[model samples]
Target: MSDSTTLVYKKKKKKFKIFPLVNAIFFIIVACLIMIPIYRVIISSIDANTSYNFVWLPSKFTWGGYTAVLTRSSLYTPFLISVVTTIIGTFVGLLVVTLGGYVLIQWEMPGRNFFAYMLLFTMIFDGGMIPKYLVIKQLGLMNTLWAVILPMSINVYNLVLMRNFFEGIPESLFEAAQIDGCSPMGIFFKIVLPLSKAALASIGLMFAVSFWNDYTNFKLYITKNKLFNFQIQLRNMVIDSDIPVDDAVNQETIGNAATIIAILPFMIIYPFCQKYFVQGVNVGAVKE
Candidate 1:
């Protein structure tokens, strides 16, 4: 290469490097800000003192808190409830959203746009707490796990994202499937779904996170202690000052452990889905 050309290429490479470095620094700062608070929560839970004093590390660490809370027969029950709810909610919710999105994009059903609009409207505006509660009560779903799962089965944003993805698929593929004697169901199960795996996995993770973190629905509808989700249980421990710490060995430590444990599942799952998550968000956010 000529000297001028080589110099220009070097300058461009340096400029590109600068931008990535700037982005890396920003990312690190944001990550540290987020991690610090979480670390403090973990620390506080393990700390012996109840005071809100700042500490970089726990003065003393003990697993007594974890054992005390976890050993209770009732404690494990809520964990079970949370796991079941998360799994069911994620699966059912993703299935419905994916199917619905596919139908909206591929099928020439009547009032499709209107229905899409309605779904989008719900995302924008809700019936508020009282009316939603009444609806749940009237349906006789209150105090059941169904209350948590049923209401949020289809997230409109995810539906729209999937719909967009489906729209992007070549119509020739569907036509070929039809010619091959494939029913709509067969096409969906065999072709469309397999092709849509990335989007599905992405939305599934989103649904899983939402269900895992939900506490309001459980708090309002679940009267049974055994039915409490992890978030609800965590909230009870954190908010209820009157709950006797002495009753549970090393209550502070246990609380910290629970806080860390509560978030650990999502932390583990996030990295796996992160690439798909970014792609999903970009594709889903694309306006039709």
Candidate 2:
């Protein structure tokens, strides 16, 4: 009886995915394109010899550029100002994005759409630069860190991203939280926030970068030289030739060094936040 019927089974085949491999190669090329420029900047900063042309490797190396930037009194104040503004601006920006986003998601709340449309309207049109200046002047924020911080604190784009993320959260979770006698603030702190790590990191990074690299707002509102941030100091050093230079380092060298200092923080920071960052940007892109 066994000999009469022979069982047949087909062997499973392994499929090679060209898309993933192609994606890897594409990303590798992209990464090198990004990293090469950074490598050049770092090498240029360390290179003691003065030359405008880009070099793959430095002929001579020295730390004089970094030392000059770090030790110079002119650069120090601006650098500190940049750091302080970035920290305060990021915290305040997070508060604005989170609260405004949460408030907009409350469907039962009165005038929610009207309030949201008002915020969106500002994105399409705004009071001109003179009026903005007049308003800042009237508020007595001129020449202060707040002048820079407050202008950037309320970004409509970030608020919208956050609102989208909030909308993606299940309505069931909110209902359950309300059933447990959780107030609005309680649900925000205990439930909403715990689910929003990715959004916070991504938006926080955006705010940090914006405030850290801010140039126009500071240059506009801050007429006083003492209030300038590091970018301004770098501009004066590199472009305007306002700051005094040390004999040990060339102006270009100091500029490159300062450039490294300016971008280095984000380079270090981004890798730590990479996982959350990818998720955060794509938060509302897909549906389950």
Candidate 3:
């Protein structure tokens, strides 16, 4: 066929579908619903004379809220505690997850099934709050960051995902490494880890987000104000509801700014790990 005729034929063959158009419209509406509130919060943070009022756009804009939030000594304690706990918590959690997952993959290990079942059982049932509090008190972890950090590492859902990811590794690689006289640990370090970057990144991000946003654990275990995390303090600011009209900025603006600051790390980190997250979620979802 002539080029023009072929082009005409292709154009004729292309029939627009209503489903795709409708789907696009639906997602666009959903995106706007999500982004509009975030945009409003950003505007409110810089707004002068801010209140619990809706701020679609700031009529009077200034950075006073950010300045107050960043410079305030009272806010500094929680921010620092959160940063420290998040870093330590993510590291400890990732270590436990990786090691635990690796152990589950070792078929010949005695009591493997028993241990796995126990882990799943713990997921469904936990010691009641009183017993948990007593344990933390007895262990001398109360009023410390370790109280929050330790519990953050024991997520059974993440454990299950890690095991599935390890299981997805090709059996041939395991047999080949054994034939080469590579110790199990050597194989884990050299072969398994290099292939499991996506899973690691995904699970690490999960752990980081969990630890960073933790308020309940910190509230329950740590009575000391000095050990409180950013989320706990943020809640305080929101509840106080006293906006100082005399000041350049008010608690309302700072509260909104604080909320943004709390979530900003993941906002920066997630885009880098997004591909790995998608791949890891898929790779770890193996059929039994």
Local accuracy of candidate 1 as per-residue lDDT tens digits, 1-288: 999999999887843458888999999999999988887887777666634676897776655556556665555777888889999998999888878987798567898888888988998898899998999999999888899998877678878888888887778898999999999999989888887777887888888888888987888898988789878877786566423467334555666767777888989989988887777666644433
- Clashing pairs for model 2 are none
Give the candidate order by descending lDDT: 2, 3, 1
Indicate whether candidate 1 or candidate 3 has the larger lDDT: 3
Q: Which parts of model 2 are misplaced by more than 4 Å?
A: 1-22, 242-248, 286-288
Candidate 2 per-residue lDDT over residues 134-209, each given as its tens digit: 9999999998999999889989999999999988888899999999999999999998889899999999999999
The order by descending TM-score is 2, 3, 1
| Model 2 residue 6 distance off true place after TM-score fit, in angstroms | 15
RMSD for each model, in Å, please?
A: 3.2, 3.5, 3.2
Segments of candidate 3 deviating more than 4 angstroms: 1-18, 51-53, 241-247, 286-288
TM-scores for all predictions: 0.85, 0.88, 0.88
Clashing residue pairs in candidate 1 (N, C-alpha, C atoms within 3 angstroms):
45-252, 45-256, 65-254
> Pairs clashing in candidate 3?
none
Whole-model Cα lDDT of every candidate shown, in order: 0.79, 0.87, 0.85
Backbone clashes, each candidate: 3, 0, 0
With candidate 1 superimposed using the best TM-score fit, by how many Å does residue 263's alpha carbon deviate from the native? 1.4
| lDDT by residue (tens digit), candidate 3, 1-288 | 899999999988988789999999999999999998898889988887777777677877878877766666777888888889889998899888888999998999999999999999998998888898898889999888899899779888888888898998888999999999999999989998898999988988899899999988988998887778888877776677533334677777878887788888899999999999888877666644
